[model samples]
Target: MWEQIRANKRNSILLLALMATVLALLGWFIGRAFSPDPAAGLFGIVIALFVWMILAMVSFAGGDAIFLAASKATPVTKDVHPQLFNVVEEMAIAAQLPMPKIYIINDPAPNAFATGRNPQKASVAITAGLLGRLNRDELQGVIAHEMSHILHRDILFVTVAGVMLGAIVLISEIFLRGMFFSSMSRRYSSRSRSSGGGQAQAIMLVVAIIAAILAPIMATLLYFALSRKREYLADAGAARLTRYPEGLASALEKLSQNTTPLSVANKVTAPMYIVNPLQKKGMKLSDLTSTHPPISERVRVLRGMAGASFADYSEAFRKTTKHSTPIPSSALKDEAVQIRSAGSQKSADSKKQIRDIGDIMQKTAGFHFVNCSCGLKMKVPPNYKAHQVKCPRCGKISAV
Candidate 1:
């Protein structure tokens, strides 16, 4: 795992540097277009780097909160969902990580994600639909997968890369939009073409236009590539941490069956999800731009595992995807782990679970809950003026 973490850091540096190069080039060219002076290009580079640094600082300071807020996630205490808290704690202990703060997204999509700059600052959010759908073992597997992201330091790279990608996209959009609404491109092109060394200036202008147009697309491809590989590693980590590939395999299958799109999901946040939240149900995500690997293939890899070890996962991944081993060779040198037996199956009352999750959300939203002696529960809205409320089911008066 340490080797993997180190490799991840190396990859992070390399990838971020590549992304920064793209950003700087775009900025330089765009700057050159506005001003033929070569020093303007340097100024553009400085501005681009400055913008990136600002975004990185913001992401490092509070990116997790922003993501959670975008997802409409409500923080939960252990009492709100003991099962989830216990599972998270259990996995944290197994992974030797501090317990991450928990959040529940009210969406009815069976998806989850982990976010933060690092392990100690990390947080995990799961959709209510996922909680209602997966049994305890399946839930544990999902939690373990997220915990893996924290353990491997994937969160920091993701946050920084996402911020970098955002900066790139933002600059490109602004430049293109400015060119469209203003006469900048035409003015610069005609002026340069009429001036001395016009040919070189014109060529540079063309190159800058191309860079502005393709920079975001290229950066996105890079981000997606990094995201896809990490998903496989996280799955492997989940398998090893839980010693049960079937749990995640089954959970992925169930999540795949859900078609509801997460309302809060967008391009910037989509890659962070356990599954690609933007993917349509039954659609195979095999394209280069996909934020995640094909769910079917991931499930197959997990189900095909011979043991609950990194070596087993790498082999399974190789056999299933026909790709090179996803796990680092050094990490695969550990002792073999025997897969654990399946946990006891209990009937899941999905409707009841959803109701309980809803109650948790309402509580977070300032709704007060009162238990009636007649076995009825009443939820009083925060704006209600009355001090007491009568249960609709039993007509039992209960003080708020």
Candidate 2:
């Protein structure tokens, strides 16, 4: 595990540096395009650094909270969903990680993600749809995957890389938007023509324009590549931790079949999810620009695993995806792990799951629950102004 962590750290640093370089270059060119002065290029770099620094600080300090807030996730207690909390606890123990905070998103899209600077500070947020859909074994698989992210320090790198990517995209957007204005373009052109180095300036401007257009695309590709690689590692880790690849494979199959769009999801936050929440229905995520690898491919890799070890996952990944696994050789050298048998526990019916999830969400939303003698459960909204409420099903008056 330590070997894997070390390798992941090394790879993360290299990727971050490359992303930073892209941001710096984009900043320099955009700055020079706006002003003919060479110093303006340096100024652009500073601006880029400033943006990066601000985002980095915000992410390091409270990134987990920011993402949870963005998703409208509310912190959940064990009582809300005993099985979900139990699975998280079980995975944390298996991963030998500190228990991470848990939250639930109200959205119907079945997705999840982990965020924090480190394991101790990490948080896992799951959509209500996920809690309501997955069975115990499936939920355990998902939690194990998230716990692996916290265990391997993947969240920190992801947060940092995401910030850098955002910086590059922001600068490029600003430059492109500025270009649409005649005055900005004419000002630079006039200055270039006034100097004897008009041709040289024109070339630089052209390069800058091209860079502005391509920088975001390039950064996005890098970010997606990094995200996809880590996901594979996380999946492997989950298999090892749970000793049941089919659990996760089945969960992934269900997640892919759901067509409901995630209400709070956007491109910026898409990569954090276990499955890319922004993926369009029927879209192939195997493409270069997608944040996540193809769900079908991931499922195939998991289902094909011969055992629960990293070595097994690597072999399966190679055979199924036709790509070299990202797992470190040292981690794969651990003792062989025999896959465990499937659990005998049967999950509640779909209607029960949905009802339980709704109850949890209502509690999270501060709705008061009043039990009526006629076997009717009255849910009073938080906004109810009355001191008393009547149950429609049982003509019973309940005190607020």
- Among these predictions, the greatest lDDT belongs to 1
Writing each residue's lDDT as its tens digit, candidate 1 over 1-400 gives: 7988998888889899999999999999988987789998998899888999999999888999898998999887775568899999999999999989999887777899999888889999998778877888999999999999999998888889999999999998888788676766576567555456567776877788789989999999999999888999999999999999999999999888788888999998888999999988666589998999998999999999999999999988888878898787778886879998989976367677677667766765667778899887777787999888878887877888
Pick out the ten consecutive residues of candidate 2 with the lowest summed lDDT: 191-200
- The sequence of per-residue lDDT tens digits that candidate 2 reaches over residues 109-222 is 799999989988999999888878888899998988888888889898888888888878887887777776865678767856646756767777788989989998998898
Q: Where does candidate 2 clash, by residue pair?
A: none
Model 2 bad stretches (over 4 Å): 34-38, 182-197, 368-375, 380-400
Error of 1 at 48 (Å): 1.4
Q: Model 1: what TM-score?
A: 0.91
Worst ten-residue run, lDDT, model 1?
A: 188-197
TM-score of each: 0.91, 0.91
